[model samples]
Target: MAETSITSPHIMQIVGYKNTGKSTLIAALTRSLTFAGRKVAVIKHDGHDHFEMDHEGTDSYSFAQAGADAVVVMSEKRTALIERQAIPLEDMIKYLSRYDWILIEGYKQAPYPKLVMVREEKDLSLMETLQDAVGIVSWLEHDKSESMKDSEGLVRHSVHEAEDIARWLVSLECHEEKRRL
Candidate 1:
């Protein structure tokens, strides 16, 4: 592992199976945070073998083809980095430390405070398997779903409760700042 050259940022993740509203929650959170004048960086964990972030004609891709090991392309609008191999979440977190908050989309096994999105009680089983879960986001607000108790201290929120979730993340950022000092 490469030595981490940056401080650990406030990190959280939304974890769930396909069609579980993970993307929805992430979008809402991003909008809310940006509106509140906070810089938020998101890292999506793609579990497919053919996840591509660069096109063949791009300079970054051309550099990679030339065995540069890592390629970085910077323009007035943005910068992109491409590496030869996958990077672990630990290192990615450091690389993104400049942001006020970092939200990950997958990596259920990652040991971070997680919000589990579920379609029904059956999917609640994932809570038991995850490394950590602080909250649950559900689209179903029926009595049956509410009756399904989550892990102790796990707060339940509706999928549309983006404002509430964003506030919670703000609180988390404050807490993380104290921890680093």
Candidate 2:
């Protein structure tokens, strides 16, 4: 099988501290992008340890015990997986290149265009830690703060302004497509 496959490739990532609405932002972005007739791929990094089998006695579980590094069990109805190994983010990105854009949840430190969700002053530094951060969506109001200012173009936006964000993201994608052409 091909390690990576794609057509037009662009990536946007959402990163933030726990419960800062990163998940909600991803959901909204997905909905808006889909509504606009764009195919989107998503990758989520889970920080937790261990995995559980939702289907305890399923064939996929048996293949996992038999030492399949990655098993993609597909049927007419659905699909499932049991895999091991640290799948590099780049590899995953390449695999999703077929989509118009890929939206990543977590992977805060990955070198990709990112939207950081922040709620407090302490979480502000994380924006710097992430690469290619284009903006921040915030729920807290910090008086006289420049947390979103940087050498790279930075946009400070309200989390509730979903339409604004969706428009901005669509514009960005349009610019990217033009550059490719």
Give TM per candidate.
0.87, 0.83
The models' CA-based lDDT, in order, is 0.82, 0.77
Q: Lowest-scoring 10 consecutive residues by lDDT in candidate 2? A: 1-10
Clashing residue pairs in candidate 1 are none
Report the C-alpha lDDT of model 2 over 1-181, residue by residue, as the tens digit: 1112134666888899999998888888888877777777888888894557435587777877878788898889967665688778998887767887688998887888888888887788886567788888888665645645543578878889877887787777656766666
Best by TM-score: 1
In candidate 1, stretches whose alpha carbon ends up further than 4 angstroms from where it belongs are 1-7, 178-181
Model 2 reaches what TM-score against the true structure?
0.83
Candidate 1 local accuracy as lDDT?
0.82
Model 1 lDDT-worst window of ten: 1-10
TM-score of 1: 0.87
